[model samples]
Target: MQVFPYSIVAIFFIHHAVGLSFGSIFNDLKDTFSYYSSSLISEQCDKRWIPENITGLEDDLEKYLHGQDLAAEIIISALRSHLKKTYRKKPLVFTLHGWMGGGKGYTADFILKNWFLKGGRSKFVRKYFARKGYTADFILKNWFLKGGRSKFVRKYFARK
Candidate 1:
């Protein structure tokens, strides 16, 4: 008779303890999930594509690319016109060709840094360098096709 009462008391205490533990576990899980979801939302918001700053780009070009007024003017005007249009049939492309040490690479780097939020470090920017004896198609097939598609891609072919 006394044992029966003691057994009931023990069972009640055990049940209450288990219920409290389970409640704490659930609350902890809820907190973790909310933190994870909020972080994901913030990361997605940060990943949005930022627009180019044409005025700032022009200033940088004029300041850094001295004696290249003609080239800078042409590039800036073309980019401004292209960006102004809401609808575009195709992507804008630029081909820079000149003798070695003519600032082709510098111009490309500057344009990328000015155009993108993260500049050359961004995942959206891709660069492919062509080695000697590698044709354009071969390079495109092997290098470009293997990698995931990016918003901007630059290909540099070495002069034979």
Candidate 2:
């Protein structure tokens, strides 16, 4: 019958479409599970470093440099306010602008060491230094522009 041929074609098309959709659904589930698991592990590994006396932080910072009391005060105040907040807020972007040998990097080190348990070695902090090979264009195109981790990036970067 003519109807038999049409039914067979329709069934074949539907079966292939359903199979493709299920494959995509499986991949989606896998990605979601991996993302959540990694996030949970990250949260659990975050070890906090809270000094016994808060005043010690200021004293420790003073040991390295001289005549930056105003800058130190501002930084301390900002840190205090950040610590007091319970919920997550927007990320704090700090731009330590100064000439070479002006103690910008030193100040950053001191801040991180006092603020976190592992200090500069903490996993939470990602330091990206501008050097000869890692030019701005490379970062803009490959790192920032790519946004998040994807198959294309993983392949390009030679990562898993």
Candidate 3:
């Protein structure tokens, strides 16, 4: 019998939908070590989130930027200066709301974008959703995929 690698164990822990089958843990397998060069937070995929040219923690999205408040004063001040120099040049007013059957890509045709937060994978919520007859795929569409660009567009594009 051979011992399984810790890296595979971590991947299973993070992505496994159900408690691991005993077979996976006990099965004979080669152990390989895999580590990331970046912090877990920075490992997030490049998502269409927030304003353009605004990569780091600076604007209203500052709340979610990892280590923003703990950053040094010099860095914070530099970020603030950058925002000031570029704020007006970029779109500022933004709105978020719910709409029904609105395809995410269609909204992007009008320049709006989607924000996919990772919280759609909460275990408590997952159980709740399952009891309500939703699988992981259904839960994802219900939570993040079915975004709408709001009814305000209706008023603006209303028939005369």
Candidate 2 vs candidate 3: which has greater TM-score? 2
Off by over 4 Å in 1: 1-48, 131-134, 142-144, 147-160
Error of 3 at 4 (Å): 37
* TM-scores vs. true structure, each candidate: 0.59, 0.51, 0.15
Tens-digit lDDT string for candidate 3 (26-127): 442222222222323332332321222323323423443333243323334543564476224432222222243332223221221112233223111121
Q: Can you rank all candidates by TM-score, best first?
A: 1, 2, 3
Per-residue lDDT over 81-134 for candidate 1, one digit per residue giving the tens place of the 0 to 100 score: 987887776667777767777777777777777776666665555565543666
Candidate order (lDDT): 1, 2, 3
The lDDT leader among the candidates is: 1
lDDT by residue (tens digit), candidate 2, 100-127 = 6676667777766666555666544445
lDDT of 2 at 143: 61
RMSD of 1: 15.9
lDDT winner, 1 or 3:
1
1 against 2, candidate with superior TM-score: 1
Q: Model 3's lDDT to the true fold?
A: 0.32
Give the Cα lDDT of each candidate: 0.63, 0.54, 0.32
What local lDDT score does residue 74 receive in model 3, on the 0 to 100 scale?
A: 39
Q: Candidate 3: TM-score?
A: 0.15
